[model samples]
Target: MFEAIKLLVGVVSLIMVYRTITGNCNKYLAFAICAIWLRYFLSAFHTITYPSLVAGFSINALGSIGVAGLGLLLIPTAVFTLKKLFPFYVFFTAIAVSGFVNMQIPGTINVLVKWCYFLVLAGALFLSIRCQGQNETFKKLLVAFVMPVSLQMLSIVLGEAKATEADGSTSYIGGYNHEAAFSMIIVSFIFVLGLVNRNAISFRTTLFTVAVVLLVLVNYRTAILTILPIAAIFYFTLVEQRLKPSQKAPVLTIVTMVLAILFFVLSLSMQERFADVGLLVGNLDLIFKAPMYFSDAEQDIMSARVYIWSQYINAFTNADLLHQIFGFGPDSWKHKFDLYAHNTYVSYVYEYGYLGFISFIGLMAYILTASFNLSNKPLGKILAFSLIGFMIMNMATMPLWNIEGLIFFALALGTVFANPSAQKVSKEIGAGHKTSMEIN
Candidate 1:
């Protein structure tokens, strides 16, 4: 049964990849599929999931063949030179160089695969940036981005949920693994949608957002921290425009209903958390002594980050110069603590060091500046504000370039930067062309 399920996943992945290799796929659509679904195909074939070595080899070979087919499809527009792809050139080159020098590069094969993954996504970014204003194409990509994710999140919620016998609070982890990425896509969509109408929530957008918000509540990972910024950004960038007289009452009604529903659901599911959150009220001690609360929950929950973060930093400090500067290669966190550094600073500094670290920050600054300054007026400002929210979330989670979801953001930035009005398409990607203070 499991094998059948795995094979089905591989078949679905193969179909999407095949469509992309042919001229039948939207570029953004292809990216959405890759970001949301392709990794599942790989997982279905991994040794731990599938005991058959032949299945493993077969899936890998199939994926490579599909990618090679895409290379052929790109022959006409593949006219990229070193100068055009400078950012990616530096990004991949630095990581490869750093990985080679690291003494702890044990998962060398895995590291190589990761490099290839980054390359393919970077290539997508280049292509998207290189070719812009395909409205029909962009719309299709947006559908691809939003639909699968919505269904996926919904499925996670509908499936089995466990209620703690002690607390009676139900916990539904759902099937969604990439919580941060999911939220980023959600807010980005909200930004784009608001940009489209701007006056008020379109009926379609209202329903879509309410659904996505419910999904976030169930996932409950970045619920509070991530949601607030997204809401605030939507209001500041998309919401607080000089409202037409007609919009006031409807807007208030919608906001009130949405907030009420969200509050009721959240309180019902995680009352324990809500009760503990009260610890923040009246008791200022919990605020200052937040780190002292790890006895309450796991690493991802309340204040546990403080404790885990300390461990990662301590481990990083004691390491030698090689490990300090170059990092321990991709997925090397197991040697230090768990599967990943709970903090971005610890992750980048320990994994790729200053080379990766600086690249991450530089890329963030460049994209954010570009997002606000695109050629398309409403679209640029909308994406810019929405993207600003995404970047802020990224700081607290993954560095910009490392996470899968940011692949879309990078692609969007590339598209924005490539626009004729914002700035000329420089021969260099991250070469020193500064934005005007007005745009920034």
Candidate 2:
């Protein structure tokens, strides 16, 4: 049954990609993104017949290389002269240079596969901007995100999602690897959808938000920390309008207070709800203990991640000048060190070195700068902030590598930085366009 579902989703995805390429109708990117996401959400139904996102299930596992149909179109259509795209090429150059400098050159297949995955993101991003020009496609993509996200939330109720014993502890992996992280990201995207559509107060949006809230509880994680940040964004945008400019400077203090109250109420409520289901992990006691994290060197030392991160940092710090500049190839450290840094930023620095890091960060800096500057408008702000939340999540986890998620990010980036839309966003932001836009 699961295999059939997976196969069906795969077929639909391919068809969408084909239409997107042949038709020169870029809006189909939305369909492809969701179709791929459906596969991720369906992983909640993992059984022996169809194991979780292992080989044979994902596109690559199904004996295909990285995305082919879209790649052909994107390769021809993508331009990198734009300041927003310069960083990716620089990062690519850094990665290529690393192979020659590092003693343990990254394996051919390993390097190629990694490059293909990133190329897919670049392709999707290029089209995403084009999608905005096709307003219907851009709107459709926004709407398409909601279905998979809501269904993914529904999966919590439908499936018996429990974590397996890996690393050491018995964690609650709602479905795929870091179900908690996945939930956090999905929920953020849900909010992005609402804001993008400017229909956050609607019943449809309410239903999805409730499901997301339920799913967040199911995961029993601090990944929902973004809620504090999000709630603050909402408050300042909606509430602080009546305040004087002097009061606006202290908005952070108000935001901090709001977060404190929210954390208390939310933690208590989540604890009680989860406890009723026999699913609560740590309750507020664990949360209140967060301060201990700052002082708890012993606990940090005991953490497997700390050990992994240390090993990675030491390798770069101790390497020769060339290795330090270029770093090991992506995942190359894991082959030699027996462990990989679980942190994405740390992992990137280890895999590509300072040069790669600078190029990548420089590129994102441009994108993010634009995102920040455009936060005055509705869709522009929504997509920009959504990207911000995604980046924050990547600080601790590597969900960005997930193609479904990566494609979504690229699409959003394009909407923010791509051609006519990018210019439009700047003008709109400068003019302080209305806070909400009707979904046309």
Per-residue C-alpha lDDT of model 2 across residues 149-184, encoded as one tens digit per residue: 444444455563555333232333334445544554
Which pairs of residues have clashing backbones in candidate 2?
none
Residues 145-218, candidate 1: write the lDDT tens digits.
43434444444455544343234444332233344444445544543344344333347356446645654544
Model 1 misplaced regions, further than 4 Å: 1-85, 103-119, 122-134, 143-159, 162-203, 235-303, 399-403, 421-440
Model 2, TM vs. native: 0.67
Reference-based lDDT, each prediction? 0.50, 0.52
lDDT of 1: 0.50
TM values, all candidates = 0.64, 0.67
Clashes of each: 1, 0
TM-score of candidate 1 on Cα atoms, chains taken together: 0.64
